[model samples]
Target: MASVAEAYVFLTYLKVLFLTVTTYLTCTAHNSPTRPMFSVFTSYNDSLEKTHGLPTNLSWSQLASTVGEDKTSSSCQPVGIYSIQRHGSRYPEQRIITTYQTFFSRIARSRINEEFAYLKNEPLDRFTVEKAECLTDKGYNELLEISARYPARLFPLFRDPVSIFTQSSFQSTETNRTKESAEAFISGLCKECRFITPKHDEDKLILVMKDGKIYSEIHWLPILHDPLLLPKISSGICKDSIAIEEHSREFYSFKNSPFVEEVLHHVISRLDYTGDFSMTLDELQSLYEICATEMNLFGASNWCKLFSQSDLRAMEYLYDLQEYWYSSYGYRINYLPYCVLLQDIASHLESSVASGSTSTKKIFKFAHSTTIQGLFALLGLYRTSVIPTADNYPLDGNWEYRGGIISPYAANIVFSVFRCAGRSTLPNAIGDVKVLITHNEQPLKIGPCDSYYCDLTTLTSYLRSKVGSCDLDEICGGVVRDLPMKT
Candidate 1:
């Protein structure tokens, strides 16, 4: 948005409180002595079983049994939700199914009718990256079949109208990549889903460009700019080498070195600049400063939102993530400004429901695993290293890139939904999140894989015991875990 001073004082209070809370909680979390962590102790009249944290699994009948226990009819509904899933598989080839002269050409004609955006000064050309944004036919069909298979997955919560969703995508929001995926998903419930991709491919998952009619270029970098409350570093890679293929392996080694930490810092300094700036040789330094400033505070998206044409930056999101992760509450790397917004969203949803709104109205955020990992790292959810990175990165690669035999691009992400108080325990409105690993609805991995109905009760029992006096809104409060910024 050009300007948003609406919450000037509130924003100021939020910023200071956030910084102070983060600093204080983080320090306490880190320094606080560790307690032998334990799950809630729930007893099923006959047997006793113990379980770990969320992304855990349970059986169906067990849940039915739990409902029977709560004959008193508690205000909070007892329910569980899951990660919509498919199976684990390789990313198939696209050339065999579709071909194009250059990836850049594909960006110009993205599925999300960007014509309107182009006319608004946020020209399509400006959005254009050096590459394309479609998925391969195989990739396209994969998501389609997934949609058809799990047509009933979300039907319980959103029968007809659903507001927002968070999905994971890789290798360019390629027509085939994002479009095909969106189509396959929406077609399942006969809901008209829209893929509003722009001509810029750099912001996509994987981007390929032509290098002087010779070798094709591939860029794994993305541009995340948020103007206000930005970072001290930049996400987008340097542009002087768009013709990256021309550089030899030896040449790139020097360019890719992380020794140039200051170089990154320099690019982040200009986020939220009020001055009217234009591209020019001298302005390179200014632009670099903007990027560096933003990166230091937020990531590229924060920079983009402030400077980019969007009226809103990252969509307001909600996360039911735990607070005081384990014990202390030190600010974790996941304490990025983006997450603050998520907490805000969750708070909003909770408030909305306290009054009156469609109970089933739910929103999902398709964000990077790093977003979660960062928080996990901050909160000590899991080992910080679980984020999947080698410490050093290849030149022009995804910052959150994690590779392996599985190619590390399975759209690994955290899928969470919001449930109104009335339906918290409802089968469809279960507020729990499911952890899955698959390209389609087929689950390559499913939590509660072993725990049956009895196990689920144990989980609730565990929550009641271990979970502090915090309410749902407090749970969403940035209290779960606090670690230093890994970023």
Candidate 2:
């Protein structure tokens, strides 16, 4: 019953008051010293549980809370979820293990140098390389935790008990880590369900080459004719000896730099390796790996103390360069493998829409970190324009935004479909289905779709175009013989 003029004035006052309060809260939150920031490594004095990278792998729950989206709106519901995840922490490779043990043995036997005086009486136990290529107990726990938490997050999407189909790409007797990771996740997710054994579907999941013999199975149509697959499309693909040697040279050349030399000297002195000994690039790499592996297994190690924060950051960048050029976004051809995966994702989404309620609710794939990295690059997520170089390593730059974070142990990329109840101008709206892509629990802002939640039809069209451009026969002709294959 109030007058129009009075009501307008009162509403304007309320709006102004609301804006003022919101602005104050936002400013307060931004300026608060207690606010948490993402850190790549914990302080030397901090407990190993606080470490965030390579060694002492981040727990899935901690990662999810730090980077994951907030609770979805009450109205928005998840219809389907597709996820591809990497296995968690594991023992180092045989060569790395040997190098670490040898290095430590030398240190233990070295006449107590002033620099390494602390280790004079410190009982240095020799490390043995056991259970190589197998998941550590911590790795198993990580997947288990993820399975428990992810379901609750997606509960609103499907009120019913959602069906899960798990797949893994580990085929070799030596590489059971992927399969174990998948089993652990399933155990956590469906406690009552039996563990499903993984099938070796090379034609669908992997590209293998042995002794110059290539077994090319074009799983995804988009990569069919892609020329990038021509260069050893198997485990050996990433092991390009020439490329690794070049990278090693670049890394070693930095030793001549005064700053690097000073840091190296300081690190060597602290580790008690001073006195007429110069560290080779190979030695430095081995030392870093030893630090990482020790921390990963035992939660703490003296090796962690040998390097400062700046040194760790530098080493991380070195690793970034290796991973990038070897099998990630930096390599142009790497996208071919993941483009196929994207097509599969598109197909699954299409089926979900076509079948409506009858479609599979969840699709889970377990693979190596390489798979996640390739997909991340193909999707152009967390990519930087400035390519890293040995001399121009951007220490002050956003290194945390690179593959180090994108492909951490147990890293995952998730695509979630939500049936939004709304109207849209696009054709085949089908109740305005939207898809959200998240890497490592954090939602990605896909540039192609230009939104966090992309319209299904638009996303589908883009993915189909990618798939349509492939001609597998042309790309894999040398190895694409008519073998009895299952698609």
Indicate which candidate wins on lDDT. Answer: 2
lDDT tens digits by residue: candidate 2, 1-487: 5699899999999986863443233211323332221122211212122223222233322333444422322235667777877776776677776776666667666754564456445443434567555687878887787776665666544233333332212121124676677667766664444433333464333333233232222132122232222222442332232244543454455544554565466566555533655555556666766666565556555665566555655665666666665556544445544556677788777666553346555777777666776666666666666655567766453443344466767777778777766664345435667777766665666757866567788887777766655444322332322322111
lDDT per prediction? 0.27, 0.54
Steric collisions counted per model: 102, 7
Candidate 2's TM-score: 0.68
- Model 1 poorest ten-residue lDDT run: 311-320
What is candidate 1's CA lDDT for residue 54? 21
State the weakest 10-residue window (summed lDDT) of model 2: 36-45
Over 4 Å off, model 2: 1-74, 113-127, 156-174, 192-232, 235-263, 272-274, 297-299, 356-359, 395-401, 422-430, 465-468, 472-487
What is candidate 1's lDDT per residue for 62-165, written digit by digit as tens?
22244352222222232213232211122223331122222223333333223222412322332222323333344344445444433244334333423223
Score every model by TM-score. Answer: 0.32, 0.68
Relative to the true structure, candidate 2 has a C-alpha RMSD (angstroms) of 16.1
